[model samples]
Target: MLDEVTFDIERGKIREFVLATHAGDTVHTSVEAARDAGFPDVPATATHVVVAGHYRDQRAFVAKLGLAYDRVVVGSVKWTYFRPLCAGDSVRGVRRVAADTRKRNLRFVTLETDYLDAAGDCAVRVREVLIERGAQ
Candidate 1:
């Protein structure tokens, strides 16, 4: 497992992320809508936004491991959300190397990341496979 990377869930960033992705969830952008939905604050962030950050953090770790980006492609991502992550929450992700296998001319690296909330509770788990072409 690699060191954890942390991020703050800012309301403005969440709103912008939803807008950029056209998530179509008003609760992600409007506090009023979230409150009307009975949330104490803005509801959980759009799932893709959280996953994107997790992917980015893992990519940085892969880079630090001296992996060349030009030969890498994302294979798959599976996400499990345990609970809602409201605005102002702090999220930290830790990456674990799940498996590495070579098939023909490609290498598949599978990784899992656990996203922890401010109270150190697991909020989400993401499993991703990255294919490295031309890997030995």
Candidate 2:
């Protein structure tokens, strides 16, 4: 056995994902998350669900990297809502590193993920932006 150990994560500094708009994914989940955070009246619809879940996912992603937050700015989410994610439904997504930019006071990492659904052979897409603060 080795007496010491070391690790590095610089190589995977960024990550992205794409998902599909699915049915059965009610907006309830998103509304609940928002309500739990002290906000109520969030539209509990499929469209809102994806947006809210996407944000939560983004935050989780940053937390996993042990990033410290001082300032964070999120870009708008552009997604197309479609059939619910249920039985016999199929979807596709693309996850990749988006952008890494820093201001004078802090460093920022922006990650974007897109999702599409199989509806009329047209895919609906959802783009999520996550900003990580103080990352150099």
TM-score, model 2 to reference: 0.38
TM-score of each: 0.83, 0.38
- On a 0 to 1 TM-score scale, where does candidate 1 land against the true structure? 0.83
Model 2 / residue 70 / CA error / Å? 7.3
Model 2 Cα lDDT, one tens digit per residue, 1-136: 1011111111111111112333232333344643564533222234432433433454554555445544566655665654333222334444445666657755555544444445434234455554544544
lDDT of 1 by residue, 11-130 (tens): 887777777777787888788888998766685554643544543655577686556788898999888888877787878888788888889988888888888887888988888898
The per-residue C-alpha lDDT of model 1 at residue 108 equals 86
Cα misplacement distance, residue 17 of candidate 1 (Å):
1.2
State which candidate has the highest TM-score. Answer: 1
Error of 2 at 62 (Å): 1.3
